[model samples]
Target: MTLKHQPAYIIKMRAKPGQGDRLFELATVGMEKSGASDRFVIAREDEDPDVLWNVEVFRSEEAKDAYENSPLADELRDEIIGLLAEPPMRIPVHPYSALPAAPS
Candidate 1:
C-alpha cells in the first residue's frame, strides 16, 4: 500500500509584470504533460497578481526524480527563466493530512 508520505513539493514564483497570465497558461499545460505530479494545482495571489503558486504531489520520489531529469524539465527551466521576476522558491514537504479523492 502506498503510504501518505510520498515525496511532495510546493513552488512559489513571482512573474514579471504583465506575464502572470502567460505563466499560468504555461503552468497549466506543463504540469499536465510533465508526468511528475499526481496532483497539481495552481493558485494566484489575490493581492499580488504577479505571484503564482504551485502545489505538486508526486506518486513517489522516483517519479519526482524522473521529472527532474526529463528533457521537458530542462526546456521548461529555460522557458520559465525569462518569465519570472526572480528564482522560484521550492519547498519540499511531508504531508500528514492530504486526503484522497472521494469516489464519484
Candidate 2:
C-alpha cells in the first residue's frame, strides 16, 4: 500500500496582553469551519504569556487554500491581527513516513 501524505501549516503569534483568550476564541471558530484534520496551540518557553504557536493539518494543499480563503478564517485573521503586537509568522510543511523501504 502507498503511504498518504498531508500538508501542514504553522502559525506563530505574539498576542497583546489579555488577548490570548480572544485569539483562541477566534481560532476555534475558524478551525471548526475549516474542515482541518487537526489544530492546536503550544505555549512558548520563558513563560511568555503572549507567545503562541498554532499548528494545523490538512489533507491537501487545495483544502489548505480553501481554509485560508474561508470567510471564517478571514474573520479570524482580521481579529487576530488587531490583537497581535506584530505580524504573525507562518510556515508550511509536508510530512511523510517511510514504509520500511518496501521490504527491500
Candidate 3:
C-alpha cells in the first residue's frame, strides 16, 4: 500500500493559557483511539509552547470524512475545543512524496 496522493491535514491548535500539555495529551489519545489515519503526528511549536501542529494522513477520503463525522469524533472535538484558545485551523493537502514508515 502506498500513501502517494493520500489526503492529509495539518491542524493548528492553540491551547488556552496553561492547557498546552492537556491539549496535546487529549489530541494524541484521540488520534490513537480513532484508527482513522495511517500517519499521525503532533508537534509543539518551539517559540510558543501553547501551539500544536497535528498532521494526519488517511487511507482514503471516505475514511477521512467518516472519521470527521463520527460521534466519537464529535465528543473528542468538543473536549479538544474546550481547551483551545481559538478554533483549530485545518489545512488539507495531498502528499506529493513520503518516506516509508520506520521499523517499529
Best candidate, lDDT = 3
Model 3 regions lying over 4 Å from their true place: none
The superposed Cα distance between candidate 3 and the true structure at residue 54, in angstroms, equals: 1.0
Ranking by lDDT: 3, 1, 2
Q: Each prediction's Cα RMSD?
A: 1.6, 6.0, 1.4
> Model 3 misses residue 32 by how many Å?
0.7
lDDT tens readout by residue for model 1, 1-104? 25476888789989999999988888888888988777877999999998989988888898889988999888887888789999999999856676778899
In model 1, what lDDT does residue 56 have? 86
Superposed by TM-score, candidate 1 places the C-alpha of residue 15 at a distance from the truth, in angstroms, of: 0.4
Candidate 2's residue-wise lDDT over 13-77, tens digit each? Answer: 88888887777666666767667544444555368767777766676777777777777777778
Whose lDDT is higher: candidate 1's or candidate 2's? 1
Clashing residue pairs for model 3: none
Model 2: lDDT of residue 86? 88
lDDT of model 1, residue 89: 96
Q: Show the colliding residue pairs in model 1.
A: none
When 1 and 2 are scored with TM-score, the better candidate is 1
